[model samples]
Target: MRITTVETFVLSERQLLVRLGTDEGLAGWGDATLEHRPGTVAAAIRELSGYLIGEDPLPVTAHWQRLTRGGFYRGGPVLGSAVAGLDQALWDLRGKWFRAPIHQLLGGPCRDRVRLYTHAGGPPGQTAAPERARAVVESGYTLVKASIAGPVGFLDSAATIARFVEDLEALRQAIGAGADFGIDLHGRVSVRHARRLADAAAHTRPAFFEEPLRPEHSRLIGQLAASTSVPIATGERLFCREEFVPVLEGGVAIVQPDPAHAGGITEVFRIATLAESYDAQLAPHCPLGPVALAACVQLDLAVPNFYAQEHVIDLSSAGSSDLAILRDPETLVARSGYLDRPTGPGLGIEVDEDAVRAAHRPDLLVPAGNPSWNYPDGGFAEW
Candidate 1:
């Protein structure tokens, strides 16, 4: 079927959804969210649509290549995310055309179920981190992930390091030895601090330490990895396979490519295969809406080295209404921390177009930027 129109909807300050309509009366949905930069990503999608409109949607890979490389100035967050959303829509259309799930089109399932992990933790320095971890584990999640909480200075005092270790230790104790948990440094720590923290918390045996250092310091990851016992996982910021080469060579045990940011299913599948060659596991970084999670689940089912899936849990007492954008929200939920392989066509979960439209907030069409933080001395801090 020929693509007739490419439309983008800014559902909220944090959600950007794309819809691809075809001449054959079929439509596919994808998430093109780039966090606080929804407006920018939406503009990118609009620009890329010039290549997709009136083109055959079945040639998913060829389309991905052109949409990605057609612009000589290619391969940044905006272009990758724009291409990612369209790529997912293309795959979704292909699955519907063939009457199969996206995973089946990618060579069928490698496993029957996909294990999932969710984020948990209170604000920085709160004693509630362990409690949150325990609650999720008690809810039947065998895996949980938490951030270090609060901004960490470049070379903080010994008390800072001790508190970081203590928080992780409390989480480990709360979850017991049966369950596993990951630590997300959020690229807030320096290489020296990452090494120090990894060494101190090695006894807790975290499932992995995620983004301990920023993307720019990826070349130094191997030195940190070699000095510590915890498995290093990154790539939430790196947007392509080429960006991931040094991370794999640096001995990162897990590759956490975000399907929404790293070129969607087509490119993430290729990233998974590349990581497989390095004997690394795939745990896609998905913190966006349902379509993104659905796309990640499809990739998780087909990749042989798939380890786990990172799903976001709104820690607010009010919870999240993000799932209202989906017709069947349960389709994306996990039972006992494991998601059942979906039988539905395309990305598996169906989009509620009316809900998506109703949830669109016009104010979000203008960027407000993410919250910024500063250190005690008034210097800038990563948030």
Candidate 2:
């Protein structure tokens, strides 16, 4: 079938979804949410659609190369994310045409079910982190990741370090030895503080420390990894295989690539294999929407190196707007901390067009970038 039209939708300012329609009437859906810049991503997708319209949609790899390399200036968040969303839609369309799941097209399933880990967001200072951590454990998840709280100084006081240790201690006590906990520093801490933070968490035995330092500081993370036994994990901000090379050499035990932002299934699969070569685990970063999560799950099932997936199981409970644009939401529902492989063709989830259209609010104004944080002296800090 030939591509007829390419369209984009926004449930809010937070998500960009793409739909590809072919002459044969088959429709494929993809999500290209780029944090707070959904409009920019949508515009990028529309610009790239010029190359896709009226072309045969089956040559996914060829199309991916054309979309990415066709532009003289390519491969930033907006362009990469635009290509990623279209790539997912094309793959979804191809899977449906072949009458098989996307993973089967890759090489069939390597695992029976895909394991998942949910986020447990807590109050500032992480004072109530343990309570939230226990709730996820009680809900049948053996693994959960929590964010570091509030603003952190470049050289925080001993009390600051102690408070973080205390929070981790509380979570360890609340969940007992049966569960594993991961910490997302959000790349807000300096190397000195990050080293101290990782050293202090030795007693807690965290599953991994995510983005302890920003992507630019990946080289120093290996030193942090060597200084402490805590497994270092990063790469959510990185968009391609080239960006991941230094991170892998940095001795990170896990690599977190967002399929929606990192060129979709095609690139993330290559990233997974690259990490595997370094003996690193694949724990995809996916805190966006359902279609992005579904795409990650499809990749997770097809690869042997996949360790776990990052997901926000209940959007409303997470204090986020409800963006359940799926006709069969149950297709993505995880049970006992594991998501059974999707059997339907394509990405294996159906989008509720009416619901998405109703939620679309292009006029909504969301300030770009995360909220800025600062120390008492008003110096810049990472959020």
Candidate 3:
């Protein structure tokens, strides 16, 4: 069947959902939320819509190639993310047409379940980070992740480093030993400071050190990884497989390619295979909504080197109604820190058009969702 229309729903300030409708009345859903810039991603989806309107939705490979490189000026968060969502929708369409889950179509299940890790709370500096970590563990999550508490100078003092270690150590003590948790540097620390922080916290035994430095300085991560015992995880910013080469060669233990930003199932699956060659694990970065999480879960089920999946508990809670956009949200829910293999065809979740339509808030602008931060000396800081 040919695609009839392409629709975009700006569901709240952070979620931009895409719906590809077919003339035969079947529709596939994808999420293209690009954090603070949903409008730009939506426009990119519309720009790509003209080419997808009459095309067959089943040829996801051809569509992915064309939509990505078809512009000749491709690859970035906006375009890669736009292609990622559409690719996810097309895969959903393919699975439904074949009467099987997306994982079954991808290479079948390599594991029985997908493990998940939830964010402890807002940021680490928030008043109740340790308490929040305890609450998440109480809610049955065996894994939880939190960010480093405050901003750092180019070269922080020993006391600053001590506080960072103390904060994570406190959370570790609160959660106890049964749980595995990691501290995300969020690429906020400089290379020297990252090494210092990682060295200081190594005794705490984080599940993995995330984005020790920015993707731009990813090669340096290998130095930090080699120096510290904690596993190094990066790659939420790198858009393509080629971009992953240095990190893989640099000896990172975990590669956190975001399916929402790294070209969806088509590219993420390929990235997983590439990581496998280096013996690296994949813990996809999925801080978006349901459709994106469903897409990551499908990939996690199919891949052998899969690690834990990341989810934003607070965002999902705020947009709790967004779950109704799925025909069965239960399939995507976590149980005892693990998600059961999805059984439904096409991404294992169906989008409710009415719920999507009602949640559309094109006018809503939540600046608090993204805050601008600065150093004590008035220089820019990563937020």
Give lDDT: candidate 3, residue 187. 85
Per-residue error (Å), model 2, residue 358: 2.2
Candidate 2 off by > 4 Å: 315-323, 365-369
For TM-score, candidate 1 versus 3, the one ahead is 1
Tens digit per residue, CA lDDT, model 2, 279-383: 998999987888888899899999999999888747323222343678777777767777888899999887777887787777643535678888788888788
List TM-scores for all candidates, in order: 0.96, 0.96, 0.95
What is the RMSD, in Å, between candidate 2 and the native fold over all Cα?
2.1
lDDT of the candidates, in the order given: 0.87, 0.85, 0.84
Q: Sort all candidates by TM-score, best to worst.
A: 1, 2, 3
RMSD of each: 2.1, 2.1, 2.2
Tens-digit lDDT string for candidate 1 (1-383): 89999999997665788999999988988888898888899989999999999999999999998999998889878888898899999999999999899999999999999988887766756423788789889988899998886688787778888888888888889999999999989899999988888888899899999999989888999998888889999999999999999999999999998888899899999999999999999999988877888999999999999999887744222224656677777776667778889999999988988887887876887778877999888889888
Q: What are the clashing pairs of model 2?
A: none
| Candidate 1 global lDDT | 0.87
Weakest 10 consecutive residues of candidate 3 by summed lDDT: 313-322
How much does candidate 2 score in TM-score?
Answer: 0.96
Give the Å shift of residue 238 in candidate 1.
Answer: 0.4
Cα lDDT of candidate 3 equals 0.84
Query: Over the stretch 145-178, how does candidate 3's per-residue lDDT look in tens digits?
Result: 9877657677888887877778888888989999
